[model samples]
Target chain A: MKNSIAALYLIVVAFNFSCGQDTANQVATISDTPFTPELLVEDVAIPWGIAFLPDGSMLITEKSGELILFKDGQKNTLSNVPEVYSRGQGGLLDVAVHPDYENNGWIYLSYASEEGEEKGGHTAFTRAKISDNSLTNSQLLYKGSPNTTKGQHFGSRIEFDDKGYVYLSIGERGARDDNPQDITRDGGKIYRFYDDGRIPEDNPFVGTEGAKTAIYSYGHRNPQGLIKNPKTGDIWDNEHGPKGGDEINIIKPGANYGWPVITYGVNYSGTPITDKTAMDGMEQPIHYWLPSIAPSGMAFITTDNYGADWNGSLLVGSLKFQYLELLKLNGTKVTDRIELIKGLGRVRDVVQGPDGLIYVGVEGKGVYKLVPKK
Target chain B: MKIFLTSYILAVIGLSLYFFQDPALEASMQRGNEIYADFCVTCHLEAGEGVVSTFPPLAKSDYLLQNRAASIRGVKFGQQAEIVVNGVTYNSAMPSPGLEDDEIADVMNYILNSWGNTSDKIVTVEEVEAIQK
Candidate 1:
C-alpha cells in the first residue's frame, strides 16, 4: 500500500509541473516617475472616453450616457446624444474624431444602444457632426446584433487609422464559450469599416460563408483599448482577462487571439480556464499582465513634451490599480513599465491631446492633464 | 450486535441534522458567490475590501449592516448619493448591475455572511422585489 501511494504522489507531482509550465509571460517591471496631474475638468462620473478636436477643445463621454464638450474652461453638456442602456458595464463608451476632422468635421461615438429587435443592449457605433453644442446629421454606422442582458464585457473603443478606416472593438458579451471562437457571432471581435457604414470589400471574412463580413480579427475576450500606432500605422489593443492574463496585442487581419481556448488566467472562482497559454494558430500578445491591472484605455506618446524618455512610449490606464502605466516599447515588445498618477481613482481613459499633453479620465472624479515635473 | 446498534443511532442523528439544516440559504450563498465574482468583484474586490476613497469596502461595512432598505435600493436602482461607509465618505456612483431580484438577494446574503460579517436573517427575493427605485 505504501509503494502504491508513493507512485500516485509521483504522478500528481508530474501533472502539476506540466500545468505550471504554461503560466503567464514575464511580468512588467514598475518604475517610479515624477509627474503631477492637473485638473482639467471636474465633477464628472465614469468618464469612459476622451477625444480632441482640431481647435484644442475636448469631448469626453461619461458612461451614464452624457457627452460633455469642454472648451475655453467651460463644460457644456451636448444635446442629441444617443441614449445608452447604462447598465453595469454598459453605457456610452468611446468617442473619437475623424482623422480629417478639419475638413470633414465628423466625430465617431460608440454606445450601448437598445435600438435593435433584442430586448437587451449591445455596442453601437455612430458618427455625427457637432453644431452649436448639439449633434447634427447623426448616422448609425454599425450595431452588434443579438443583444444580451449580461452586465459584463462590453468592449467598445473607437479608433481611426491613417487610411481613413474606422475600427471598433466589441466584447464577447459574457458568452465566452459561444461567441469568441465563432465567426458568425458579433462579439469578441475587432471590426473594420469605411468612414461611412460600408463594409470594405477586402475585409478578411467578406467572401467567407456565413462569417461576419466586418470582422477584422476574432477570438478576443474584451478589448477596451484600441489605438493606431502613429509610426507603424498598425492597430493595437489591450483587453481585460478573467482574473489574470490581461493582454496587449497588435491587430492583424483574420487573426485568432485565443480567449478561452488558451489563456494564462483562471476563473474568478480560482478555477483554471485552460492550461494552455500558447496554441498553434492563436496569436500571442506582446505583453500580458499576470495579476490583471484591468486595463481600459490606451494611447501612444508621439511628442517630446514629456522629454525623450516618454516620447515613443505607450500609455495605458489601469482601472484595478488606479494608475496610468507608461510602457516603453522596443519595436512591439514592452521593455519597461512605469506607473504614473497613482492612487487618484480608477483610471478609465487616457489620451494624447492636440496640445501634445496627456489627459487621463478617472471614475467618479473628472479629467486631469498629466504635466511632467521639471 | 453492539456495534450495529451504535451505528444505527449515529445514522439517525446524521439524517435529522441534515434535514433540519438551512439548505435554502446554503444553496443561495453558493449561487451568490458566482454572481459576486462576475459583477461585484471588479469594484468591491474578491474579499469585499474595496479601494480606498474610491470604491468602498463591503467587508464589515457599517453602512451595509445599518441601512438595509437603502442597501437593497442601491442594488435595485443605481446608487449616486453621498453615503458614509466605515466613517469614510464615498460619493462615487455605482451603476445598477441589472441582476434579477433573486440574484440580488443571493449576493446580499453572501456579502452579509462572508468576511467576518454575521447576519441572523437571510435576504429574500421578496425583500429585494419590495425595494423601490
Candidate 2:
C-alpha cells in the first residue's frame, strides 16, 4: 500500500542497526605497571584541565569544545576554542596559563556563555592572547549572575596563589535553595582576581550591596577543587555532594560552604539534605566522602617524587573512585588514606609536573604519567 | 602516467562515496542506542566508564561533546553538583531522564556519534522543544 509501508520501515531500521552495542569507559588498571604509564592520547573527549607550557608544553581542556596541544608527542588544534555555552554545567571551562606566562601571553578561560532572552547560559571569565598558536585578545574576565536556563550549575575553575592571587570557582547553578540567600548571586561563590582583570581590595564582597564585588567565599556548592597549600598558605577545595555528600574544604576567607542548607547529602529523591551535620552558620567539611567520592581534580603531592612516602601527600582525583585518593594530612586532619590509581577511568584532573612527575587525566583513558617505581 | 590515472579515479570516487552513504542519523542512532541502553546504561556505564569516583564518563564526553544545552539539560533534568569535565572537577549525581522529546534526540545523537565522536551536530526535537523548562 504505501510502497509496502515504506518497505516495512526499512526492515525495522536494518534491525536496529545490527544490535549496536559499545560501552567501554575504561580506568581500573592495577595490573600494576610499577609506573610505566604512558598511553599519551586515545579517543579523548572529556579531558579537563592540563596546563603546562613554560615550554614543557601541554594545554588540553576538551569538555567538548576542544583546545588540545600536547607538543613533542604531538596533537595540535587550538584555533578559537570558544563557542562553549554547552549547558548543564556549561562548556570550554578552565585553562589558566599566565602567571606571567613567559612574559604575558596570557590565557585564562572558564566557560558556559550565551545569556539573554531568559538567560540559558552563564559562568564566563575570558582573557585570551596566544598568537601564532591560536586565540588572541578575547577579554571578558568574569560574568556569571542570575543567568538561569536550568543547565545545572556552572562553577568554573581557575587557580593561582603564591601571592600572584587569582582563584575562581562559582557554582550553585541548580539553585539548591540558592546556596544561602543569593547575596547578589555569582552562583555560590569563591572569586578574587587581578591578573589584569582587577578587583582585589581583599574581596569578601569588597563594597557589598548587590554584591558582584568579586566575592572570595560564600556558601559554595560546586567548587571542583583548587590547590595551593605549600604547607599552609591555605586554599584547598574539593566539592560535589548530595546523596552521600563529597566535600574536602579548607578554603576560608569569608567562608560559608553550606548548601541546600547544611547537608551531608540526601535528596535525589531520597530527600533531606539538612536535619543535621551540625549547622549554625554552616561551614564544616575538612573531610567527607561517604557514598560519593565524585571529587575531581586536585594535587598537593609536594614533590619528593612519590618517595618521602608521598611527601606531605594529598593526591585526590576520584571521578567516583576510578582511583587516586591519597589524603594523609596531619595538620588539617585527613590522616592517612591511600588508593593510588586503582581502576583509572574517571580521574579527570590531577597535576604536578615540571618533571616532578604525577599527571593524571582520564575520562576515557588518554593522559597519564605517574613515574617513579625504581 | 597522468598522475596515476588521476589517482585511480579519486580512489574510485572515494570508495563509492563511502559505500553509498546515507547514515541520515542511522535511524536516530538506533533510537539513541536504545535510549542509551535502557536509561544511560546504569551510571554512564555499559561502556561510558562512569563509576570511578562515582559515575561520569560518556566515552568522548567533553561534557557531551561540549555542553549542548547543558548536555540537553542533562538528558532532560538530571545532573548535580559542581561538574568540570575535561579540565577535571566533577561533583557527581546525574539521574534525570525518563525520556521524551524524541528520546532526548535519540540519545543525544547516540552520544554525538559514538565513542570517538566527530560531531556534524544533529540534536533535534526542535532542539528539545526549545530547551524545555
Best by lDDT: 1
B38-117 per-residue lDDT for model 2 (tens digits): 45653566556564445567787687677789888867866555776666676654535445678888888887777787
Each candidate: how many clashes? 0, 33
Report the TM-score of candidate 1, chain B only.
Answer: 0.83
lDDT of 1 by residue, B4-88 (tens): 9999999999999768757888889898898887789888988999877778898999999988889988988878888889989
Q: What is the lDDT of residue A171 in candidate 2?
A: 77
Q: How many backbone clashes does candidate 2 have?
A: 33
Model 2 Cα RMSD, 1 decimal: 23.6
lDDT string, candidate 2, A329-361, tens digits: 777877556667676577878888777787888
Name the weakest run of 10 consecutive residues (lDDT summed) in model 1 chain A: A21-30
Which CAPRI level is candidate 1?
acceptable
- In model 1, the number of clashes is 0
State candidate 2's TM-score.
0.30
Interface RMS for model 1: 2.2
